[model samples]
Target: MALIRSILFNLLFFPGTAIHCFGVLAVSPMGSGPVQAIVHSWSRMHYWLLRHVMGISFEWEGKLPAGPYLIAVKHESMVEAIDTLRFADTPVVVLKRELADIPVFGRVTRRYGVIPVDRDAGATALRQMMSLAKQAVVDRRPVIIFPEGTRVPRGARPQLRPGFAGLYRMLGLPVVPIAVDSGRVWPRGFVKRSGTIHFRVGEIIPPGLKREEVEARVHAAINALNLPTT
Candidate 1:
């Protein structure tokens, strides 16, 4: 049953997404407003399919703070990445350079002002990211980055990446850390199971602390879901 549902979901969702991509491409010349509206629609379409077709839903622990701040999210699956776009304020994500180069979607990422991180580029990449992030802050758009730098399996906690700290200090914005338990249901496999993905939004961690202090607080905040519940 799950397999059939997954098949049906891909049949509808993928084509629907492709059409929206083209829609974004056609309206890119107008401005960021039109572009973001199209992306918002695409994110909504994905959630609609995720719920109706796959029987998956979301449960948030706390309210997401107002934007123009940093959103440091737990990286478990692609679910949270797509969910970020659902924000009406429409954040500019710091994602890998490869992802930003993905055919048609890559074009959308650039047009929408995504901060593409070239991991191998070292300090140069970090400086470039800070520059782009500054522009996003000036534009009043929230910045989203997977502090771990990439998706990890459930229960696995790694130190926050250095670039995350670099951006934190550079932006000088409070960070809202969110822990997610999506991999249990939204695994890397093609067939997905029906379940509620929990997003545990932690309290705002203020800026201006040293790198170690900031990293420690955020690391704990985003892995709150991994703590043993007695």
Candidate 2:
């Protein structure tokens, strides 16, 4: 049954995502408002598919921060990535450089504006990511990033990549860490179990703290919902 639901959801998700991407591209000249509406609608459609076809739903705790704040999120599966759009107000997401290198999806991400981080580039990548992030702050757009750099298993607690601390220091925006336990149901497999993924927003951390302090605090906060690993 889970396999059938997963297959059905993907059947709808992939084609629908492609249409949403192109829809944003077609309305690019109309500016950010229309593009954001289409983007939000895309997320809405995704959740609808999850609920109706897969019997998956989500719940949130803590007040979602208002204004342009640095949002640090746990990356357990693709579920939280899309959910970021639901949490923030039309924010610019910082994602892996490879996602921006894909064929069709690449063009859409570029058009929508993302801070693509190339981990292989070391200092150069951090510099570029900060540059894009600074502009996001200037535009009063909230910035959402997976501080772990890549998705971790449900119970894994890895220290955040340095780029997160860099953004925290450079952007000078208060950091709000969100912990997600989505992998139990949204595991990277052909089957998706029916369950509720919990999202917990931690207390906001002030900016301008030393790198080590900020990183340590965020590391603990974002992993608040992580299950104990064997």
Candidate 3:
């Protein structure tokens, strides 16, 4: 069943990739509103295809926070990234700089207000990320970030990067922690698998908390979600 599903998913990828490419071209000159709307629709379509092709299911716990908040999500599999877009309500993504250089993908990402960070450049990227995050908040858009910096294997714990702290400090908005077991199903790399993906959206950690305190609280929330179910 898994092999069949994988083959079906591979077949679907071609058309989905074409739609994404055309969507990117359609939005390149104007990066706002209609463009973002089109990209969001295409993204959801891609996820829908993925879910059907792979026989994967998801369960999201807790409510999405109201108003502007910094969403710090666990980074485990690429599936989580696509799921984020599929599930969220047009969020402004905070992504790595390398993605911005990709041909079609880059254009679509920029159109959707994805703030790209140069991970190798250190402080400069951090500062720019914070600036873009603040603006997003002011624009009443949620800022989604993967605080773990990079994707890690299933059940492997990666240290949360300091850049998250900087964004939290600079934005001074509520931080919502999201934890998920996406790796269990999709794992890493490009191969597809079949299973349920569990996502737990922790409470919104309000502003005015100390950086370390917020970090610790969010970390604990995600860790708690990562634990065995039974």
Note each model's CA RMSD in angstroms: 1.9, 1.5, 2.1
lDDT of 2 by residue, 1-230 (tens): 98899889989999999999999989989998888888889888888887889898888898886789999999989887987887688889999899999987887787777999887787777778888898888888899999998999888898888788878877889999998889989887778899888889999999889998999999999998898633
Q: In candidate 3, which residue pairs get closer than 3 Å at backbone N, Cα or C atoms, i.e. clash? A: none
Lowest lDDT sum, 10 consecutive residues, model 1, at 221-230
Superposed by TM-score, candidate 3 places the C-alpha of residue 105 at a distance from the truth, in angstroms, of: 1.3
Provide the TM-score for each candidate, comma-separated: 0.95, 0.95, 0.91
Q: Compared to the true structure, candidate 3 yields what TM-score?
A: 0.91
Cα deviation of 9, candidate 2, in Å: 0.3
Off by over 4 Å in 2: 122-124
Model 1 C-alpha lDDT per residue in residues 70-101, reported as the tens digit of each score: 99999888888988888526899999999899
Model 1 CA deviation exceeding 4 Å by range: 227-230
Model 3 lDDT, residue 52, Cα: 81
Q: Which 10 consecutive residues of model 2 have the lowest summed lDDT?
A: 221-230
Residue 16, candidate 1: Cα error in Å is 1.5
